[model samples]
Target: MAKTASDSVSLTRQAYALTDDLMTPNAAVYWIDLLVSAALMWGGFLLAATTSSLAIGLVAGLISVLALYRGLSFIHELTHIRDDEAPGFRVGWNVLVGVPLMTPSLMYEGVHNVHHVKDRFGTALDPEYLPLSRYTPLSLAGFLFVALLAPIGVLIRSAVLTPLSFLVPPLRRFVKQRLSALVINPDFVREDMARVRPAWLFQDIACWLWSWAVIAATVAGWLPLRFVLTGLAIFSLATFVNQARTLVAHHWDNDGGKMSLDEQFLDSVNVPPPNLASELWAPVGLRYHALHHLLPKLPYHNLGKAHARLAQALTPDSLYHRASQKGLFEALTALFRRVAVKPVVAEHGRHAAE
Candidate 1:
């Protein structure tokens, strides 16, 4: 049964009431998880770099992807974290994971929250949204293919664009507004017009120096070229894994229109238990993504507990239950199966008109 507007309101209220106690961000959990993930990622990358055996390198490479993917996923949590709740964690994450990965928190912090806005959710204006189901299957493949190039793209952005932008004020403004954000929507423009922010400026400078150092060291023969290439390969794999996970994150059913809260929740998905692989692919509590949409402020550590609470309280036929998915494959399959040719014709017509 389709959930009525009142039922959505009731569900939203119940969600907040059931998980209000879980709202407090646990700094200890944040620090420990970040540190452990960093260690595993670095350790795995080092092992892969040093190992001679192909099998050992492959295993180590996989570990690096999973570890780094988990660590980088913290960027999402950092955005949702209250300002006073996890003090210094943002800087710590930038230093430990973000800048190193070439995906600093600033790239996502100002951008992601917009995706959750009532009017923006699933709309073309939403930086993180795209109507995938409305497109051809070829578009889906193109999306994944583009994700493969992300590491190389960001490396160039930091190494070349960072210094070049400094020399060109107009370019600086352009970079901050367009290139700085991590968004899926090509047309989304950043609203930031301020001259300076110490936080993002710090990350930009750090990444600039680090990116140049890596390139210079590799070119000057100070860093082994093979090792650098291996690391890039591993990073690319991690990125591709994330892109695959994203393909099933939501239904991508909405056109360019405002949606009610219930409408947005139904469009999103949650791959809870019996889908343990989600723990690795959708790390940092992303498996409960739809639920996260409801409790935006809920810490990642408590997402599972909050999910269980809501599940036990809500009925089987409730919107909460309907939001859940069995696994990633099922969700992706469902999304692609709904694709239509009429949307393709409309899309081409729109492009031709332009």
Candidate 2:
């Protein structure tokens, strides 16, 4: 009886270990992500320092930005982990791979998870909503203006106003629930602006530390400002493009109720550029967004395989046709042509009935 009980306990332990591995992202993929991101940042710095050429710096910066995007996508997976689970491991993983690129993974994941929850996520709830307001220009020139200024707009909405929301008690409460480590599925936003969540102070410290490190390095002449600035510019552009893609995937003719996890995947198009060799260039793992959204835990390398499985399981209508590398520009043009005329509706959620 003693031997039998011991065997049973060992079996149980083994099973638990197996389950943990399956639930977590594969180790190989995680390592690959780290290597890719490090390579991009280090490579960009190296090239920038050696040549002082803006073009080289831009290319290198773009590569690092793309890597950062992929790294953040992995964080999205950890956010979905059950509240009972401590996400510190995942949080640490993100900071290790993502901070150098200006994407604070924990803060972004906290906010983005709210954007995913069907109940509270919509134009009304998400501050990132960029509807064609009067602030939006009406002419072709206006479209260009908004697109060019997209980064500035995002900074105002996410970096500035989001933190400012903390000033209001009610608003602070709502945002806090969503961000609180103790609560799962907390109210992401309050309909009334008075109840926003306070800005996460830890995230602020992280951003400050990252910025200071970069600045100090440049100031020490360990790196050139021209290279650093050029890289930052390229990264900013890539971040804007990724944001635009999200707006397209989730915004467009915003019928918030009509949106779904499946539909977002369908509507979200991937544009692979002609420079296949440049996979490291503008947001790694983006070509597999549908897969990333569906199986957030999967690492970048496995995303394509997951997508293949998803494609096989779902119907044709469930998937939107993807834009090719050469077709991304044309696709953007078409999207802009109708942006004003098309109302940005909410995703399929509580508002879907309307």
Query: Per-residue lDDT for 1-354 in model 1, tens only?
Result: 556878888998999999999999899999999999999899999989999999998898899889999999999998888757978889889889999878898899889999988877876678888777777877777787788889999998999998999999999988888898888887778886466888889889899999998989999999998879888988888888898889888887777677788889898889998788899989999999999998888999999999999999988888898888898888777777777442652331112111
lDDT (C-alpha, whole model) for all candidates: 0.85, 0.46
Q: Which stretches of candidate 2 lie over 4 Å from their true place?
A: 1-24, 52-65, 68-78, 81-97, 121-123, 126-203, 210-224, 255-284, 290-300, 313-327, 340-354
Name the runs in model 1 displaced over 4 angstroms. Answer: 340-342, 345-354
lDDT of 1 at 145: 74
Q: Model 1: how far is 334 from its true place, Å? A: 1.8
For candidate 1, the 10 contiguous residues with the lowest summed lDDT are: 345-354
Which pairs clash in model 1?
Answer: none
Q: TM-scores for all candidates?
A: 0.95, 0.59
Q: By lDDT, who's the top model here?
A: 1
Residue-pair clashes per candidate: 0, 19
